[model samples]
Target: MKQVRIHGPDDVRLDEIPEPEPGPDDAILAVAACGICGSDVGYAKLGGVQGPAPEPVPLGHELAGTVVAVGDRVRGIEIGSRVALNPGAAGFGLGSGGPEGGFTPRLLVRGAGLGKSLFPIPDDMPFEIAALAEPLGVGMNAVDQVDVQPGEKVAVLGAGPIGLSAIATLHDRGVEDIVAIDLSETRLEIARKLGAKDTINPKNDDLWNDLGRLHGTEQLYWMDLVDTDVFIEATGSGALLKKAIERGGNGSRISVVALHRQEVPVDFMTVLMKQMRLQGAIEYPERFENMLELLARRDLGPMITHRFRLDEFSTAFEVAKSPDAGAKIMIEIG
Candidate 1:
């Protein structure tokens, strides 16, 4: 078997290794495809899973594959069945108990029970789309946190994969007034294609001034003057959070779905004055099915912009890291 190992920052190697033998309650998967997540880049830059490189670690979690070998205890799922993997059971990286992820040709699926972690997708779903179920699930989870009403305006901060997924989810729910805010014109264009009624490039346009055009109001107010009832901050930009607090409509909900490592200073008074509800969103271990359900109905092929074979991981990583790179970047393992 061949696996991608991160020995240190910017050091990734494809190494030959022994394939895993599944236990009675486990299974061995022949990986089909895996998506490169931002956290994987973090691991490469930090030299390891949690901190500096202490030992080699496997990277990649958003994956889908076929069950080549199944333990005797594994039921409901059968050999050669296509399945989408939930890496959340393991902390999503090598440092945690998560099975060495789908970056390898073969991976082990083991736990007290495999039901929650292994979701069977429709046989017709392409492996790449199946692999996307994980991140799309994340978007579904974040959107689920907010009670977005129909006809209400919504603004998403960031045009990354997750942010676009959020827009797709919101669009699916019948929300037509969506504004996607991002610094990338390319991403904003993608957002427009996905469902955003308007795309704002913070680099060129004043967000506050633009809101007036979006809502047809000079004074953006929560008292029906401002129509943005929900704001989803999908970027890790701390400044966006402050802007949401300062400008978000009264009683609007803000779903903070970005991965932020630093403490952001927010104006508590603004939050109080607006009576806004702010919440954080993490993994979508439970929303995989819902995500697949949504994917089943919509055309999500556009979300995937870059694809690379397992051996081309270095180039894949470079593309995934580039801001100009469009959306989902997948590594074909099989």
Candidate 2:
């Protein structure tokens, strides 16, 4: 067997190793497809999540595979069933310092019968699309953060994978007036495909002006604010936090979905005056079934824009790092 692991600082390798033997409660999956997330890119640079791993660490988390074999104690799940791994669930190595990850052909999942880490997928769903369960779950959390409802207006400040995922989730939840904001026209186009009613390219357009014009405006004391019901901050821009506060209507909910490197200052006075609710969102806690429901509703195959074979992983990583790269970069394994 071959696995992708970070050996040391900037030291990722494709090491040949023995196939894993499953425990009594474990199962072995013949890996299918894995999505290269932004975190995977960062971990590659640092050789681990925060620092170099004591041992070689597997580098992928967004993945789907089929069960090749299962231990006698493994109950509900069976061999040949397609399933998606919960990244938050430990054991099936996912960018964590450990034994393995899903970047290869075979993966050993511990406690497969415990019903904690794996969720079966529809037989008809492609492995590449099913691999999206993880990222889409992230998108679900962002939408859940703001409690977006039907008929409410939304403005997402980034059209990358997470932003686009949020937009798609909003659409799935029946939200109509959705606005996608990004500097890339291409990304905006993708956002539209994912159900963004309108888009704003901040490079040539004023984000505040366009938002106000589309969402309508409300007067608060001497200041005017965009009446958008929900604001999902998918771009990690400190300035956007201030802008959202400045223009966000009274009682509007703002969800910070993007990760920021530095501290972002906020005007608590304005937040206090408007009674706005600001929340931070990260991984999906317990919504694997919700992800499967969304995947059942639509063909997420379109979300995948680029695909590469396992052997061409270096090239795939390069493409994922490119600004011009399309929506989801997938590494298809046999």
Candidate 3:
């Protein structure tokens, strides 16, 4: 079997290794597709997320695959079941747990359990779309963190995969007035389809004015505040924190989901005076399989804008980093 391994900064390799043999309580998944996350790119830059990797580290987490073999102890989950692999079961997920990752042809799941380590997807759903349960799960978690109200307006700062997931989930929840704000018009267009009632590109139009006009405005002492109740900041821009604080209305919730590298100074006095909720969100506390139901219902196939084979992963990373790649880039192996 061949796997994608990160040797060091800007160094990745296709390493050949022996395939896994499932134990009595294990299963083997023939990986079909995997999605490259921003964290994966960051890992490549740092050599490893935890620390420098003396041994090359495996590199994939968001993935879907088919069951090629199942242990006798593994009941209910049978061979040939089309499943979405969970690389997050504490010490069991690919790349995160052991030597194996989904960037390979096949992976072994120890103590394979249904709804725990493996989630069965619809037989008809494409593996690429099923893989999205991972990222979308994080988005759902972020949405849950803020406790979104039904009537409150929302402005998502970044229209990336996770932000789009939040938008889609908001749409599913009947949030009628969503404002998707980003520099990428391409993503803004998709945001509209995903349930963003309004879209804004700061490069072309004034973001503050568009937000104020679309969401309505209230005077906060001397500053004009956007009346949006929820501001999901996924853009990782330090300046956005200031914008959210300055324009966010009283009692508005700002769910910070993006990973910021630098520690930006914040106006605690403003937060205190406004009584706004500044919340940090990460991971999917609620089940991501629920997202599978939404995907099955809406066929969010269009959200996936780019696809590449496992061998062309570098090219895939290039496209994912490119502004024109739109959203949700997948590496198809099966």
Best by TM-score: 3
Candidate 2 per-residue lDDT, tens place, 74-176, comes to 8998788889988657454455555668888988887777877789898888888889889888888999977789999999988878888898899988998
**Candidate 3 global CA lDDT score:** 0.84
Please list the residue runs of candidate 1 whose C-alpha ends up more than 4 Å from where it truly belongs after superposition: 90-99, 216-227, 285-287
Ranking by lDDT: 2, 3, 1
User: Could you tell me how far off, in angstroms, the CA of residue 43 lies in candidate 2 after the best superposition?
Assistant: 1.7
- For 1-334, candidate 3 gives per-residue lDDT tens digits of 7898888887878789789898888889999999988777777777776657778888888889999998877888878999886677736646752677779888887778543778899988998989998888878778889998788899999999889999988888888889998888889888988889999999999998889899898987777788989999998899988889888998899999998878978998888888999999987765657878887887566678888888898888888776556888898898
Question: For each candidate, C-alpha RMSD in Å?
Answer: 2.5, 1.8, 1.7
Q: Single out the weakest 10-residue window by summed lDDT for candidate 2.
A: 90-99
192-239: candidate 1 lDDT, tens digit per residue: 888999988878898867875796542334333354788888888888
Off by over 4 Å in 2: 90-93
Query: What ordering of candidates by TM-score runs from best to worst?
Result: 3, 2, 1
- Clashing residue pairs in candidate 3, if any? 87-93
Candidate 1: deviation at residue 27, Å?
A: 0.9
Computed on alpha carbons, the lDDT of every model, listed in order, comes to: 0.80, 0.85, 0.84
lDDT of 1: 0.80
Task: Give per-residue lDDT, candidate 3, residue 168.
Answer: 89
TM-score of every model versus the real structure = 0.92, 0.94, 0.95
